[model samples]
Target chain A: MNKSERLFQLVLLLRSRRTAITAEAIAEAMGVSVRTVYRDVQALVLSGVPVEGEPGVGYMIRPANHLPPLVFTPDELQALLVGNRMVQAFTDQDLAKGARSAELKIRSILTEHLKQHAEQQPYRIPILESDDGLREVHGKLRRACEQRHKVRAIYLDEKQEKSERTIWPLGMIGWTGKWTLLAWCELRHAYRNFRFDRFEALDLLEENFRTTSDISIAHYLQSVIGMRDPG
Target chain B: MNKSERLFQLVLLLRSRRTAITAEAIAEAMGVSVRTVYRDVQALVLSGVPVEGEPGVGYMIRPANHLPPLVFTPDELQALLVGNRMVQAFTDQDLAKGARSAELKIRSILTEHLKQHAEQQPYRIPILESDDGLREVHGKLRRACEQRHKVRAIYLDEKQEKSERTIWPLGMIGWTGKWTLLAWCELRHAYRNFRFDRFEALDLLEENFRTTSDISIAHYLQSVIGMRDPG
Candidate 1:
């Protein structure tokens, strides 16, 4: 790592531990010599990081000296924890994984009080329903939307008429409980919102399309607003 | 707080500190007697919390015995910090405030190691531009949609003709860089997506609307799929 990164790591190392950490331990963790650790500590102290050291004991950062930016009020912490749970429960598996990982990271960083506060928070977004089929489709469409891939799907319309259409996937929008894929349809030659459950099969194509101003989501929404009709 | 809450708080109090805390300090922080603090610590030890108590030094929770749930990988921590910054940069002020507060909470809890990781994540989402008028309008529409309120809006159509419409706000949809109000337009007697910039005036009426099956976002999305045109 760079000098700046090493210095930052040193600070975080000190912050993570509650007791004084010895220069030998710091050197071991940071992959440097005790002399280097001492030099870095000196550099940090010189730069107003308020790192305290004892000759025989070790080093510690005095509380409230630096890093108020990381501090959160109780309610904020509660909200974050709850929000993570909600995301995990509500979104696709990839997002759920991200939320879970995010929550774990958040949990690891919290002080004991905040950790307890999070654990005891009353809110819960229990996984009430889940369909593996829908999750697979959602994940596929989400990836397509992000990567701007075209999708060919056998869709069942309102009247149960089956048709295969290739669409340039723009976005996966969640409306209440349902998910809709907003796309520029090749058959309709218009922007259409395809319902997830109505698709018998979805084939993500390798052919990619450039996001021109005409086919952009903004342009499509403008057409929806009757600002200009692309249909 | 209840007994369970007190027990949890006592555990957290012990966890937050690097050094052993005296019973007097615990009592003062917990708003309990030193005797009660001692009793709680004893209760915690019996409950398998691995609390270490010294007569003169006071008490501390042994490291790694609890709180694995809160720990985060370096990459995960980076994602969260970046995500929060992105939310603050991309969303409206109210959501930005929430994101900021959430970041603070996450920061406050992070061990120095993770804090350093977050700081050195080598990614940024700079606020390139902001429009206060757009933000205000977005905020207003968001609230109306959330509360299912009737909104009276003077809108400029494609022909530049102004028309007053009382609409039931269903959702505020963001497409690319633009935002649209998805509503049940009273004038059109159909679902209409109104672009934010074209709204000449918007009044969030005190009159709220019930989310009937016909007017719900899910139902509207179903219509967008050509399942049934609610128009």
Candidate 2:
């Protein structure tokens, strides 16, 4: 490794340990001579990088300087990219956008060389397929859910009966290629789930609602499916 | 800023834009003379930090150099410290430990001066009152969750009836003052929500289960509360 790289690694090792690291210990970890470690420590110290403790007593990194920029190994980058891609593919609309934004921010932090490799990296995450119409409706529903806006829709039941309803969207779920919206339905005077594909027309009303506490749409579903007690 | 710092900032600016930056542009950005910008650029190039293009054509960071260490600004560190502290406070056993581990890892990466400041920094995130028991259950539950082992617990229902149960813990929730676990109950043969405060005699079973897909427990909770339907 180059001098800069070695220094960076030394800093990383020192920070990992709670106790002070001796030069001999640092030498062993970096596979360098004790003399080289001493020289490197001196260089770091001279360069205004913090090196705590004397040569024999070991060293501890004093946290007062700016953090080094985030550096990711190739595999790490791949993991993040894949995870973000998955989020964009499967998440609700507002969350999907957030995921995309995060990916962009991460790219901005990468060094020039790594950034190029990242761009050339052909990592792809498989996304579950959903109907185009359903995807569009799910996107709008997600926005309404986030904004706590009221929505009006013509929902078709499992029995194929149509009903007009207004709801304060609380959350949404994607299951087995279908999208489900969990909302506080005004018509039912209760929380209800409506299938996106079964909805003929969905509209975001001007009316907004207060945000509720964090609750699981899955638990509601399990209860609705009789897997758990509704109460 | 020092010449090195200015050079670093200039490189960052060029990389962010994905375009060549002229010495004139660098001088303007750093409020320095063009001569100083030229000298700084030369120094960076001499140090083997890649800068592409001739002087007349402007300079661009070559996308091939290894990134410097991960650095965080003050505001960024504060944000991370706060977010991680919250996660440590409210999350399940495994996640809280992970948060601690992450904090340790972050500390290791800081420059020496920053390390001192970090040690002296009196910024402690206050734990919320409701999730106090979260600290107690965090370690054990986290390990069990990570291992995917069966967990035995004395659970209390809304009616205050106590029942012994074994569950496959899938996720956790921290809301207001309550810590809830989303788990696949072997007893019920379905997913259920159990409050951490209500759990007694918690034990981890030896046998482990296969890892499930990544499902957000929050979404699951919404469904449980009649906010959404599972179908």
Q: Which DockQ value does candidate 1 get?
A: 0.07
Tell me how far the alpha carbon of residue B94 in candidate 2 is from the true structure, in angstroms, after superposition.
Answer: 6.4
Please state how well chain A of candidate 1 matches the true chain A, as a TM-score.
0.65
lDDT of 2 by residue, A135-157 (tens): 57767886786567789888889
**Tens-digit lDDT track for model 1 on B116-195?**
75644323234435566776776788678656779999999889999998999886554334567778888888889888
The CAPRI-style docking tier of model 1 reads incorrect
Worst 10 residues of 1 chain A by lDDT: A119-128
TM-score of chain A of each: 0.65, 0.52
Report DockQ per prediction, comma-separated. Answer: 0.07, 0.04
Which ten residues in a row are the worst by lDDT in model 2 chain A?
A119-128
How does each model score on TM-score? 0.42, 0.36
